[model samples]
Target: MDTTALEFSLPNAAAEPDPFSIADLSPEIRFAVLFFQRDHYCTNCREQVQAVADRVDAFRARGAEPVSVVPEPLDRVEQWQAEYDLPYPLLADEDAAVGDAYDQPVRFGLLGSVSDFLGRMPQIVVLDRSGGEGDPEVVYTYSSNSTFDRPSIDELLATLDDLAADGETTSTDG
Candidate 1:
């Protein structure tokens, strides 16, 4: 499926009573890293998180913040944090509410028969922090397999730079 056609609505994190929100987040070009893990048992989970963190660092160097949202417990997130030595904050979605908001379904593998669903694909939602509420421009989106097909940190950073530059010009004009 063409990822560009996928529509997303912000998830209701209110259930968790977290202070984090689109408003609480530091306003600058921001990227939402959303991942759905069935059991958090993937062998490459740590590696993928680190790869994302590395990309986030590239964005940070350019003044952009990347927020990773994972559908897992705080403990799991913490474990991943320590294992991956991530620099960015990781939000926990214990109920998978946030993931569901993005229409990210749980995948069922061999464990599917016993478990609820399988892990979701790694997806990124780029928001122009300066854009209005109706719909933040989705600069990019990728499928679960896209993790392997994921763009390099350098490429993602360049793309974000272009988007931010474009936003600055447009905002100034308006």
Candidate 2:
């Protein structure tokens, strides 16, 4: 999928919340690090979400809001969030529409297809909306075929830091 072309709208994990659209986030958020995750059944996915939750402050310091996107219903999504004590938003992409837009991988074969039906494969996308307007630029993107695959926290932080630095330089040059 074309990262530049995709836009998204998923229900935020918050109670009685409205749909969180990428357009709505773009203007205010310097960066939105979206974690496209499979269902809670995937232990690695759960761990990955927790890892991001652990460093929520660090990401906030860098002007990035890390939000997890799960392919589950709102009720289940809320249950998972409360159960895990996740600090960040876990948007419900129930139909996997957002997942499909981002081209998050899906397993093949019968069992794989069952997994696919349950949810999407794991991936991470960092959108630089500091520029603001239009579709926020895709500063970074990573997809994994296996459940165990995920980028280290250090790597994610470095990418955000690098993007922040680049933004600073660009703004100052103007």
Candidate 3:
């Protein structure tokens, strides 16, 4: 997928996120790590988010900001904000358009298509904005195969480290 072509503006639940659109990202943010959640009630998703919250500083050290996208209403995402108090951005993708644009996985044919909880798997997309003044590009992508299948914070850090090591490592199969 050409991530450069994707654009979305969501109601941010946490603080200002610089909003992941086609426009150029802020100068400080080298990479935008987008976490496509499975659903509002997935325990794994909750744990994963908490884990990210714990190691957010590590991500910042690497010039990466982790953003969680929940395919639910604003109120739902607000509840997440109240619970996690995430330092980074937590977005409310009410219609799941952004997730769809990024092609967030849906495992169960009909059931998954109808319900995000049943079908939607996790996706971790790393957008590289190191190319200053230009729109950030999708440098790495990780679409989970199952509910509990997702990348660890360390692994995500490694990918960002790799991105810094050499520019433009585009891999959709991550």
TM-score of each: 0.65, 0.83, 0.91
Q: Which lDDT values do the candidates have, in the order given?
A: 0.52, 0.74, 0.82
For residues 62-137, write the lDDT of model 1, one tens digit per residue.
6566666766677776676666666665666666666566554334554633343344555555555555444445
Q: Which residue pairs show collisions in model 3?
A: none
lDDT of 1: 0.52
Per-candidate Cα RMSD to the true structure, in Å, reads 7.4, 5.5, 2.1
Model 3, 1-174: lDDT tens per residue?
Answer: 455736577888886754544343457888888999988898899898899999999999998888899889989988988999988888888888899988899878999889887888889888877666656788888988887788778888988888899876666543
Model 2 CA RMSD to the hidden true structure, in angstroms: 5.5
Name the best candidate (by TM-score). 3
Ranked by lDDT, top first: 3, 2, 1
lDDT of 2 by residue, 1-174 (tens): 354636766778752235776666534558888888888577888888878888989888887888888888888788777877777778988887788777677777557546664435788878777654566777677877677778788888888888887743211100
List runs of model 3 lying over 4 Å from the truth.
1-5, 17-25, 172-174
